[model samples]
Target: MDALLTVVVPVYAVEGFLETCLDSVRAGLTAEENAAVEIIAVDDASPDGCGALLDAYAARHGGLRVLHLSSNVGLGPARNAGLAEATGRYVWFVDSDDRLPPGSVRAVLQRLRSSVPDVLLVDHLREHPDGRLEQDASSPLLAGPATLDRLLGLQHTAWNRITRRGLLTEHGLRFPAGWYEDVPFSNPVLVAAGHVEVLNRVCYHYRIGRPGAITATRSERHFEAFAQYDELYQRLDRLGAPAAVRSRVFTLMINHLLVVAGNDSRMHPSCRRRFFRGIVGQYRRHRPAGHRVPAGPAGLKHRLVAANSYPLYSALRAAYRLAAARHRATERPPAVSPDLSATPRPVQTTSLR
Candidate 1:
């Protein structure tokens, strides 16, 4: 029988985290549940020992399958290769650096059996470097509505959504190569999905600030975000998505580009001006009619981009950073406090005087 779910993990230089990731999928699954799910790990020509490790793990686990590629094709294409071989009703592209939480597989299976949605969106926790786990802020939105605008507002990650294979194949929806691949792939899936459901349970644990992680690394490749958004806009146009949906996507595109522009870790220092220029061009090209920018600092950023005022934006960013530093300093608690017990008494000062 064909499996119900296919979990495609694209492995690169993540040997350190691969075992935990693989184990998490099978951690709490019963034999029948395990049999009903397929796990595919693609060895994307990683320079590290990931390939050998995958082979060893697959040898030990009868159900695990590993696909070895001759060349490194980045994360998007590696996932595509695994999807091509998937034999499950639904497909999930999971990153090797991340892991599913305990009972996550069971939750997903239960949902799939009951709902059979074209797209099943689940919640996730973001694991920070300091060992903190925080639920995604938009988790509540999942239960409210399954509209494309609401789906777009949620986190734009492939791993959070388990999609019906037929929906993807019918729409020719595949991840494109390059950075910000999720932008193009995730949005289009949400737009194309006819029946969507949300699983409010936290199914995945995403690690943040990991060393050598793409989001934490500084590179000019981040500029690929522009091209990816361009592809997404074109796809939406072809799909004849509603005007509101397009406008929402345009807002999200500007917000994402601004985030990349502001992030010190992702955007190189030298590329700041050029990146701002890219943002300005995108704003002019994609900004919808009568679109309302978000409120507060974010809204201000949208206005700045619309006006093409990079210099003012730079100055405001600097001032905001300075004020934030000061605010943090003020909010810090005292390192040490006076101990009243350790202090000497007045010692009958009145009598002594």
Candidate 2:
């Protein structure tokens, strides 16, 4: 019998965290639940000892499968390789640097058996460097509705969404090889899914500020976001999605580009102008008809993007940063001195005699 769920983890240079991720998946699963789930770890030609680690772990764990690729394909293609080998009814593309919380697999299995949705969206906790856990702000939206807009509004990460394997195969959906691959893949799955369900519980722990993380690394590859969105628009056109959906996606694309433009960690200071120009080109190409820009500062940024005014956009961003710094400075609490004027009192002690 095929397993009910397949956890596809694409491993790269994540030797430091792979064991925690693998262990967490089986942490709270019962014998029966364990039999119902399978794990496929794709070693994307990682330069570290991740492949050997995977093999050793799989030797100990019954349902854990490992695939070692000869070449270093990026995360998307590695996930594709794992998906190709998956034998479960549903597939989850989990990152090797992240892990499921205890009981998360059980919760997901329960939901899948109950609702049988084509797609199941779960919330995640962002694990900061200081060991703090914070729920994603968008978690509240998952409980409201399963609408396309709502799904699109959620984080465009692949791990949060558990999709039926048939839904993906039937639609010929596969992650493209590049950065921001989730944008092209996740959105379309949500758009094409016949029925969608949301699990409000925090199921995944996403590590933030980790070394070698693409989001935190400064590189030119971040510009690939534009190409990813282009592919997304093309897919939407083929799907013949409604105007409203297209409009929402357009806004989302612009907002995403703006975020990339503003993130110092992702976009280098020297590349900001070129990235902003690319955003302008994208705005001109994919802007849906009769689309309304969002309100306030976001709307202003949209206008600047439409006008292709990189200079003004840069200035606006600078001003906003300055204001934010000032606001933070003003909001800081003053240090207080401890009082030393209190009279001394006799200490009371309890005797065990």
Candidate 3:
């Protein structure tokens, strides 16, 4: 039988969590659904025994397909490899370190079979190091008159969303081979899609604060997010997007700047001066004229960055860090893992941009 759904998992050095993630995937699908599902796990040259583990599971499962990369190609390329091999009607991207909630696969398959949408969006539950699982907060875009506006406003993570395989292939949309690649691809896909379904249910369980997770660590590559924003805006412009779309794109540009400049605490100290300079330049290049100034702490940071005031921006970032620390301190320590259904996922996504 033709597969109804294909789950693409890009595996790296996730030996500790790989088994749990796979187990969750296996349990999430019903026996019938399992027969109609294909799990494409691309082992990205993990130095650990993850490749072997995946092979062992593939040996036991009929629908499990494992692809091995000779060398590390990062997350984007690894996903690309899986995408190339996928043959299901719908495609869902899941991180190797994350898992799906019980019955999620069956639920997703039922939805797609009933009425296929160009894209389907679901919520996520985040497991924190402090042993708390929280449901992700809902975005206004999820409940709106579905339009390009809503899609642009949605988070850029590949998870928590499923797209019709044809939609992606027809548009020739693929992740870029670098950090923050999701931005350009995800934004354009949402805009290009004709129909989108937003389900408020929590389908994916995301783990946060994992030591060695790409997002938990900071690097100069964080700057790539700004480049992605530029590419997204350029693509929208080339596609002749309307004023409303352009306006939202401008807002995204500002948000990306703030995230890279003010939010990234792991950024190298030497890169701060250069990063701030790039932020100011991007702000000038993209800020929409006559746009109402954003209000709130974020608005303040935006203005500071736009002003190109190094001292003030630095101070504001320091204060933001302190506030975040104090907030964390108030939460319970890492005692026991919270039930996956307890609280909602934290707003933090792989794409902080």
Candidate of highest lDDT: 2
- Each candidate's TM vs. the true structure? 0.91, 0.92, 0.87
List the candidate 2 regions with Cα displacement exceeding 4 Å: 327-353
Ranked by lDDT, the better of candidates 2 and 3 is 2
Q: Which 10 residues in a row give candidate 1 its minimum summed lDDT?
A: 344-353
Could you tell me the lDDT of residue 320 within candidate 3? Answer: 80
Per-residue CA lDDT of candidate 2, range 179-287, in tens? Answer: 9999898888888887777777678888999988998999999989989999998888877788989999998889989998999989999999999999999999998
Q: Over the full model, what C-alpha lDDT does candidate 3 score relative to the true structure?
A: 0.76
lDDT by residue for model 3 (222-319), tens: 88877877887776675566677677777776776666665455466788878888888888887767765568986787787778888888887788
Clashing pairs in 1: none
Candidate 1 lDDT over residue span 1-353, tens digit each: 99999999999999889999999889979999998899999999999999999999999987889999999999999999999999999999889989877778887888789877888888777777765676567766766645566778887889989999998899888999999889888878878877777776677888999999878999999999999989988888877778888889888888878888988999887899899999999988888788888898889999999888989999998998899899998895332111211222111100100
Give the count of colliding residue pairs in each prediction.
0, 0, 7
